[model samples]
Target chain A: MILDGKALSNQLDVNMKAEVAELKATGLSPKLVVIIVGHDPASQIYVHNKHRKAIKLGIESIIERREADFTEAELLQLIDQYNCDDSVHGILVQLPLPKHIDEGKIIRAIDVHKDVDGFSPESVGKLFNNSHEHYPVSCTPKGIMTMLSHYHIDPKGQHAVIVGDSNIVGRPMGALLLNAGATVTYTHILTENLSAHTKTADILIVATGVAHLIKAADIKPGATVIDVGMDRDENGKLVGDVDYDHAKDVAGAITPVPGGVGPMTITTLMQQTIELAKVADHRTLQPVR
Target chain B: MILDGKALSNQLDVNMKAEVAELKATGLSPKLVVIIVGHDPASQIYVHNKHRKAIKLGIESIIERREADFTEAELLQLIDQYNCDDSVHGILVQLPLPKHIDEGKIIRAIDVHKDVDGFSPESVGKLFNNSHEHYPVSCTPKGIMTMLSHYHIDPKGQHAVIVGDSNIVGRPMGALLLNAGATVTYTHILTENLSAHTKTADILIVATGVAHLIKAADIKPGATVIDVGMDRDENGKLVGDVDYDHAKDVAGAITPVPGGVGPMTITTLMQQTIELAKVADHRTLQPVR
Candidate 1:
C-alpha cells in the first residue's frame, strides 16, 4: 500500500479550513512570517509554496524578503521585531542563508513560542525532552509521523532503523519513534555494515541525501519504509534514498518521493501554525502524551 | 573481571583534585550549591555524600537545607540567586522534593551552565543532540561511559541494549552510546519481549528499579553488563536489576551494586564541576566533536 501523502494532506487541509474558520469566528486569525534571504532557487520555491499555502489556509502570510548581502545583525533585528509582534504566531526562516550570516545564531534569535520552523536549540531540546508543552517539531519528521498514523502502522514494539543522524530529521525522528515505544537503531555514515542494522528494521526511515542508498535487499521483507531523501539521480530526475521501484515490490507500504513527504511537510507547517495560534489565543496547548 | 567503579572513581578523583588545585592557585574555586528540601533519608544520604566529596576535591560546597513545608516559590527564588551569582559554578537541587514543589519546574529554573545534575531539559537535549559544546551529562550514564573506557570496551560496532527508559539513565544512555558509534536499542516496560532484545546485546545496561529483573538466561555470553538499579531485595539487602550471582557466571564482566555505579556518579559530578569552572575562567571549553 502506498502512503499517499498528497491525499492525506488534502484531508488534513479540509480540517484546517474548518479550524481557521472557527478561529476567525472567535476574532483570532492565524498569522505566519517567513523570512528568506538571498535567491537560492530551491529556497525560493519553498518560500513561495509556504506563503501560498498560508493564504489558502486563511493564515495571514507575511514574507520578509532580503538580498544576498543581508547582515547577521539585520536578520536578527527582523526576528526580534516579529518576536514582539503579538499578531505573529508562527515565524519561519528559510534555510541555507548566505555565507555571511551565522544560521545558528539567527535560529537561536527566534522566540521559542513563535518559532514555526522548530530549528532553535530550545525547540530541539523540547522535542527531545518530549516536555508537557506543545512545541513545533521539524516538519519532515512531523509529517512522517502523520504518514505512519495514516497507514495505521504502530511504531510500538517495532524495530525501527533510521539511516541518518541529522538534527532536522533523523535525530528527531528517532526520538519520536522511541517515545512511541519502538526499539530504534540509528545508523549514520559512520556506521559499519549499515545493512546489518537495516535488515532488522520493522520500519526503515532513510533521510541521507545519498541517492538510492537503500535497495530492496536492505529492506525487511514487509517493512514500512518512509523515504525522506530528495536528491537528483544520474538522469537529473528527483529520487529518494530508497530504490522505490524494487523496494515497493518487497515492502508492505512505502511513500513516493515528489508526492510523499514533500506535500506533508508544508501541510504540517500550516497545521502547527494554526495550533500555535490557538495556543497564543488561549495560552493553553496540552502536551501530546 | 569486575568492572570496579570504586577504583576507577578514585583515579578520577585524583585527577579532579589536581585540576581543582590548579584552578584555586589561580584564585578561582569551583563551587557547587546543593539545595535540599525535606528530610527524606535517601535524599539526605545523597546530599551528604555529594558535599563531602566536593570538599575532598577542594570544590566549595554549600548546602541550603529547607524544611518539608518549603514552598515552590521559595525554591525558585533560591535558584534565581544561584543563576545570577558569578561565584557559583554549579547548582544542584536534590531530587524527591516535597510534594508541594514541582520538580520539573525547579529543574528548568537552574541555569543550564550551572546545572551540575544535568536534569534540566536543555541539558538533556544537548546530551541527546550530542552537541559540539560540552554540557553536563547525567552522572550515572557519564560514569558508565567512563567505566566502559576504563575497561577498553569501545561501543563502536557494538550492540548496546538499555533495559529502562527513565529520562536520567536509559534514554540519555542510549543517546550517548549511539553517539559513540554503537547500534543502540532501548527496551522499556512497553517492550514486547524484553529478553528478545537483551539476548543480542554486546553491551547491556540495566536501570529498572525492579530487583533481579535480568537473570543469567537473559544475558548474551561474554556481554558487558552495567547495572544501575538501586533496589532492596526481600532480605533487605541492596541488589541490582541483574541477578548478579547468576549473571556473573555467564557475563564476561559486570558492575557490583553497592561498589560499582554508585561511587562513579558522584565522581563524575565532581569532574564535570571542575571542567565547568575551567570554562568559566578561560571561556574556551571546546565542543566534543
Candidate 2:
C-alpha cells in the first residue's frame, strides 16, 4: 500500500482551515513570521511555499527576507523584535544562513514559546525526553508521525530503524518512534554493516539524502518504509534514499518522494502555527491570582 | 575482563581531588547543594552517599531535607534560592520526590547553570544534540562513558543495544554512544523478542530494574555488557538486570552490580560539580561589554 501524503495533507487542510476560522472568530489570529537571511534560491522557494500554505489555511504569514550580506547582529535583532511581539505566535528562521552568521546562535535566539521550527535546544530536549507536555518538534518528524497515525500504523512492539543521524529528521524521528513503543535503532554514516541492521527493521525510515542507498535487498519483506530523502539522480530526477520502485514490491507500505513527505511537512508547519496561537491565547485567558 | 568501575572511580578521584585543590587555590570553592523531599529510604541513602563523596573530595556539600507535607511552591522556592546563589555551583534535587511535588516543574526551576544532576530539559537537549558546548549529563550514563573510555571500549561503528528506556540512563546512554559514532538500538518492556536484539549487540546496556532479566543465552559472545540495574533478587540479595554469574563467561567485559555503575555514578557527579563550578567562574570572569 502506498502512503499518499499529498492526499492526507489535503484532507487534513480542510479541517485545519475550518479550525483557523473558529480561532479567528474567538479574537485570536494565528500568525507565523518566517525570517530568511540571504538569497538562496532553494530557501526562497521553500519560504514562498510556506507563505502560500498559510494563506490557504487563513493564518497570517509574514516572510522577512534579508540580503546575503546581512549582519548576524542585525538578524538577531530582527528575531528579537518578532520574539517580543505577542501578535506573532510562531517564529521560523530559514536554516543554512550566510557564512558570517552562526546557525546555532540564530536558532537559540528564538523564544521557545514561538519556536515554530522546533530547532531550539529546549524543544529538542522535550521531544527526546518524551515530555508529557505539549511541545513542537521538527516539522518533518512530527509530520511523519501524523502520517503514520493516519495510516493506522502503530509502532508498538516494532523494530524501527532510522538510517540517518541528522538533528533535523533522523534523531527526532527515532525518538518519536521510541516514545511510541518501538524498539528503535539509529544508524548513521559511521555505522558498520548498515544493511545488516536495516534488514531487521519492522519500520524503516531512510533520511540519509543518499540516492538509492537502500535497495530492495536491504529491506525486510513486509516492512513499513518512510523515505525522507530529496536527492537528485544522475538524470536530474528527484529520488529518495530507498530504491522505492523496487523496494515497494517487497515492502508492505511505502511513501513516494515528491508527494509523500513534502506536502505533509508544510501542512504540519501550518498546523503547528495555529496550535501555538491557541496555546498562547489559552495562556492569556488564565486568570491571574 | 571486569570493567572495575569502583577502581576506576577511585583512580579518577585522585586527579579530581587535586583539581579541586587547584581550583580552591585559585579562589573558587566548588559547592554542591542536594535537596531531598520526604523520607524515601533509598533516596536518603543515595543522597547521603553523594554528600559523603563530595566532602571526601574536599568539595562543599549541603543537604536540605524537607518534610513530607512540604508544598510544591515551597520546593520551587528552595530551588530558586539555590539557583540564585553564586557560591553554589551545583544543585541536585533528589528524584522520586514526594508525589505532591511535580518533578518536571522542580527540575525546570533549577538554574540550568547549576543543574548538577543534568535532569533539566536544556542539559538533556544538549546531550541528545551532541552539542559542542560543555553541559552535564545524567551521571550514570556519563559514568558508563567514562568507564568505556578508561577500558578502551570505543563504541564507534559498534552495534550497541540498550535494554531499557529510562530517561536517566538508557535513553542518554544510547544518545552518547550515537554521538560517539555507534549504531544504537533502544529496547524496553514492550520490545518484541528482547533477546533477539541483545544478541546482536556488540555492546549491551541493561537497566530494566528486573533482576536476572538477561541471561547468558541472550548475550552475544565477546560482547561488552554494562548492567545498570540495582535490583533485589528472590533471596533478598542485590543483583543486576543481567545474570552476571553465567553471562560473564560469554561477555568479553562487564560491570558487576555493586562495584560497577554505582560508584562511577557518584564519581561522575562530583566531576560534573567541579566542571560546573569552573564554567560558572569562567562566565563571571568574562570581560563586560
Candidate 3:
C-alpha cells in the first residue's frame, strides 16, 4: 500500500481552510514570519510554495528576505522582534542558512510559541518529554505519523530503525517513533553492523542523502520503507536513499519519491501555520495542533 | 567487571576538590542551589549529603526549604530569582515536590544553565540532540556512564533495554545509552512480552521502582544490570529494582543497592556544580565526564 501524502495533505488543507476561515471571520489573519538568508533557487521555490499555500489558506504570509551578509546577532534580533510582536503567530527559518551563522542557536532563539518549525530547543525538549502538549512537533515527523495513520499501519510492537542522525529528520524521527509505541534505534556514521539492525526494523526510514544507499539486501521482507531523501542516482535522475525497485519488491509498502513525503512537509507546515494562527492568543501556554 | 558508582563518586569527589580550588584561586566559588518542598526525610538526607559533599569540594551549597503551603507562583518566583543570579553556578531542585505544584513548569522555569539536576526539559532536549553543549545532562545517567567506564564496560554494539519510563531515570538513561552506540529499547506499562525483551538485553538497567521486579529468569546470562530504584520491600527494608540474590549469580556484573545509582545522583550533582563553577567566566560548556 502506498502512503499517499498528497491526499493526506489535501485533507489537512481542507481542515486548515475551515480553521483559517473562522480566524478570518474574527478579523485576524494568520501571520507567519518566514526568514530566508542567501539566495538559493531551491530555497526560493520552497519559500514561494509556502507563501502561496499560506495566502491560499487566508493567512497573511510575511516574507523577510535578508542579505547573505546578515550577522547572526541581527538574525537573532529579528527573532526577538517577532516574539514581542502580538500579530506574529508563527515563525519559520528556512534551513541551510549561510554556514557562518550557528543554526542551533538561531533555532533556539525563536520563541517556542512562534516556533512553528519546531526547531527551537524548547520545542525539541517538550517533544522529548512524555507530555507533548507544550510545543509544536517538527513538521516532517508529524507528517510521517499522519501518513502512517492513513495507511492503517500502527508502529506498536514494531522496531523502527532510522538512517541518518539529522536534527531535523533523524533525531526527532526517533522521538516520534518512540512516542507511537515503536521500539526505535537511531544509527549514524559510527554505528557498526548497520544492516544487522536495519533488516530487523518493521518500519525503516532512510533520511541520509545518499542515493540508493539501501538495497533489497538491507531490508526485511514485508518491512515498510520510507524514503525521506531527495538525491540523484548515477543516471542523474531523482532517486531515494532506498533502491525503490528492488526494495519495494521485498517490502510490504513503500513511499516513493516526488509525490510521497516531499509534498507532505510543506503541507504540514501550512497546516501547522493555520493551527498556530487559530490559537494565537495566549500561545505561550496553550497547545498547538 | 562491576559498574561501581559509589567508588566512582568518591573518585569524582576527589577530582572536584582540585577544580574547586582552581576556581577559588580565580576568586570564584562553585555554588549549587538546592530547593526542597516540605520535610521528606529522604529528601533531607539527600540534600544534606549534597551540601556536605559540596563543602568538601570547596564549593558553596545553599538550601532553600519551603513549606508545602507555597504556591506554584511563589516557587516559580524563587526559581526566577536564582536564574538571574550569576553567583549561582548550578541549581538543583530535589524532586517529589508537593503534588499541588506543576513540576514540569517549575522545572522548565529554572534557567537551563543553572539546571544542574538536568531535569529541565531543555537539558533533556540538548541531550537528545547530537552533541548538545548547554543543557546540563541528567546527573544519574551521566554518573552511570562514569561508573561503567570505571569498570571497563563499554556498551558499543550491545542490546541495552531499559525497564520503566520515568523522566528522571529510565527515559534519560535510554537517551544516554543511544548516544553511547547501544541498541536501546525503552519499555513501560504498555510494552508486551516484557520478559522477551528484557531477557535479550546484553546490558539491562531497571528503574521500575518495584522492588525485585527483575528476576534472574528475566535477564540474559552475563548481562550487566544497573538498578536505579530504591523501594521498601514487604520486609519494610529498602531494596533495589533488581532481585540481587538471583541476579548476582546469573549476571556477569552489577551495582548493588544503596551504593549503586542511588549515591551517584548527588555525587554527580556536586561534580557538575564544580565544573559549572570553574567555567563561570568562560561560557565554554564541559563535556560529560
Task: Choose the strongest candidate by DockQ.
Answer: 2
What does candidate 3's lDDT look like per residue over A1-289, in tens digits? 7777777788888888887787778776778889999998889989989998888777789999999999999999998999899898899999889988999888888887788988776777777776656567788877887788778889886878888877788888878777778777677666667787688778998999989888999999999899998998778899889998888789898888867898789878876776676567533333432
Pairwise lDDT winner, candidates 1 and 3: 1
Assess every candidate by TM-score: 0.95, 0.97, 0.91
Model 3: residues >4 Å from true position, as ranges?
A217-222, A282-289, B84-86, B156-159, B217-222, B249-252, B283-285
Span of ten consecutive residues with least summed lDDT in model 3 chain A: A280-289
Docking class of 1: medium
Put down candidate 3 lDDT per residue, B145-210, tens digits, no spaces: 778777888987787888876677777887888777777777776676788779878889898888
Model 1 agreement with the true structure over B65-127: per-residue lDDT tens digits: 999999999999989999999899999998888988988789889998898887876677677
Task: Report the Cα RMSD per candidate.
Answer: 2.1, 3.2, 2.9
lDDT of 1: 0.88
* Most accurate candidate by lDDT: 2
Model 2 ranges with Cα > 4 A deviation: A283-289, B283-289
Sort by TM-score, best first. 2, 1, 3
Score residue B6 of candidate 1 by CA lDDT.
95
> In model 1 chain B, which range of ten residues has the least summed lDDT?
B280-289
Chain B TM-score of all predictions, in order? 0.97, 0.97, 0.95
List clashing residue pairs in candidate 1: B132-B287
Among incorrect, acceptable, medium and high, the docking class of model 3 is medium
Candidate 2, residues B18-122: lDDT per residue as tens digits?
Answer: 989989998999999999988999999999999999999999999999999999999999988888899999999999988888999999999999998888888
Name the runs in model 1 displaced over 4 angstroms. A283-289, B283-289
